[model samples]
Target: MDKIQRNERLSVIIKTLCDNPNKVFTLGYFSEMFGSAKSTISEDLDLLQKTFKKNSMGNICTIAGASGGVKYIPSVSEMDVRETLEELAKELSHPDRILSGGFLYMLDIIYNPKWVNKVAMIFATKFSGLGIDCVITVETKGIPIAFATAQYLNVPLVIVRHNNEATDGASVNINYASGSAKKIQTMVLPMKSLKRNSKILFIDDFMKAGGTSKGIIELANQFDSKVVGIGVMIETGLPVKKLVGNYHSLMKLNTSEMQENNSIDIKPNI
Candidate 1:
């Protein structure tokens, strides 16, 4: 490959590193890929890291150990956070977007492992020093992302089901008002999943009025657990006051700017 081609190839490799949070690539691997010497590969990685940081995009982390490698971490600044959130809000609020029965069709976003992994890594870093012992989420959709976060933090996950099904093996059920219905619904969490005085982080796919979030908080109380923080993949901006506070979100669904064909232009808030 020509010099220009080599630079482009190096950029592609660096982008891949940024996309996978928990993935680490060794210098030997890159050296073989580009048919370049170890020193040349190292210089390319160094240039990529400096260029990325100069653009305020993120950072490249190097691990030093027998099995160490390089990894890219997303760390957008505070100003970028606002701008990205605003763009996401516009995309989410489009008129074509339809939400049925208080639930938004945001599974496409949450099910995306790459995007969700990036989000969890960012949250794990921000809350690493906050004394968090575990991560909790209401069952089904939020399970995958919550599991990812727990995996990153090396913490156990507590799932809150919609009801006490026989599968849960003697779960605890509680009645609480739902966000849209304004009526009571049963929420269940399996016993023995958490312990007393442990700090828990709440993770959910989406948040509207936060009624379910509040229910999780109450459930946590049964075990003498304290909710350290709340996080949502997407938050629909509404007039209703949120029940569970201390929250972080990647994007806000304004629901006024959603376009046709389900293609949403999401701006990264974090």
Candidate 2:
């Protein structure tokens, strides 16, 4: 292959990360991608991170202290998303790796007790003075993030399931169009999860079309609860008419161009 220009290489790497967040990468991988040395990649990341801040975009954080790697999280100015994704992109970029299915394969990060604890701390810090009474999340994938947020905030977590079942006992269900699934699905949140007149924060792993988010807001209204904020690990840059007016996103997705120009579009929007 021909020599890769520094600016072109940086653009490609950022795009790759936007395509897949919460993925970790090794230094050796970067060396090969850019045909540069480890030290050079490190310097490039530092410069890019500074650029992010200067541009009011976001952060590209480094994780050290054993089992460490680089991660690009979507936090900071451009958008508010968790910061663990930059590292994830590094790992997923390896030529030999295989990631099939619709799954994000984030079990390793989600199951890491230490990381989860730290994440909780971060969320708590953000919501500490926000007067939050409860945390809300959709069923399945979002449970972990929501639980962590609730734990740190010292509030209860309200789960909204996609389908109502006997296991849920009784719930308030609403139908809305899901952006990721691209279909109308019923979202159910138990009636007993929140107190009447409670203040709430919505937390989810990903926000696409925000159909599920809208459903959760409706459920909160049924119990006389008010939504104060919304938090997510990733936010696909689509219309947000379905989401609450005030919210936080860790990362924003730029599906407009996938690898053609800037694939990942990893920028932080507060």
Candidate 3:
């Protein structure tokens, strides 16, 4: 086979690393693929790392030791994070987005792939170092965001639902009160969904009193697992204290303004 050009090697290497975030690829693997020496592959990786850092395009990390290699860690720069969240807040702050029940209509933003991927990048960047085994979320709206986060983290996505289906097989169920409405609700998860003692990260679209997050913690306990982190796209400013204390929210929505003035007061939490 003809020798692969340096530019060709770099292109393929960068694409492979970015496509499979957080997955290690040994230099030998790339060296064999390119029919190049390991030292040559290592030099290529060094150049790629510098390029990524210069462009603020996440990270290309090299791991040492026999079992180690290289992996991509998806991240966004602080400036990009701020700009993305601010743009989202502006879109969500439109008065027309206020529903009769004082709820903001954000389906368009959350469901849009452009915005979802950007938000997910923020979540993944913040929690990537936590050694998370899986990304978990409740059914429906949070699914997209959680799924994207799982993709960026290169981990499995575990979804918790309100009701169990026969296809779910045997399951575990728990009842918890809603933080805002104070209504009792049931959460269901399949027995085989999560492995025991796994480290979990809960990702959601919104948080009010954080009852849902608290419930997730309780559910994690049932599987003998632990919730290492909790991340929400938006959280209410009211009730100041949440059912759960520790969590990271991208934006803060002022509940009083939305209810009384019919105006939105949302801003980036960062």
For residues 144-163, could you state the per-residue lDDT of candidate 3 as single tens digits?
99999999999999999999
Flag the better candidate by TM-score, 1 or 3: 3
2 or 3, greater by lDDT: 3
- Return the clash pairs for model 1, or none: 92-255, 93-254, 93-255, 93-256, 93-257, 93-258, 94-256, 94-257, 94-258
**What's the true lDDT of residue 121 in model 2?**
45
Pick the winner on TM-score between candidates 2 and 3: 3
Candidate 2 lDDT over residue span 121-181, tens digit each:
4565566557888888776777787787676555778777777777666678778776567
State the lDDT at 243 in candidate 1.
Answer: 76
Q: Deviation in angstroms for 119 in model 2?
A: 3.2
Error of 1 at 20 (Å): 14
Model 1 TM-score relative to the real fold: 0.63
In terms of lDDT, the poorest run of 10 residues in model 3 is 1-10
Clashes of each: 9, 35, 0
Question: Relative to the true structure, how large is the alpha-carbon lDDT of every model?
Answer: 0.73, 0.64, 0.95
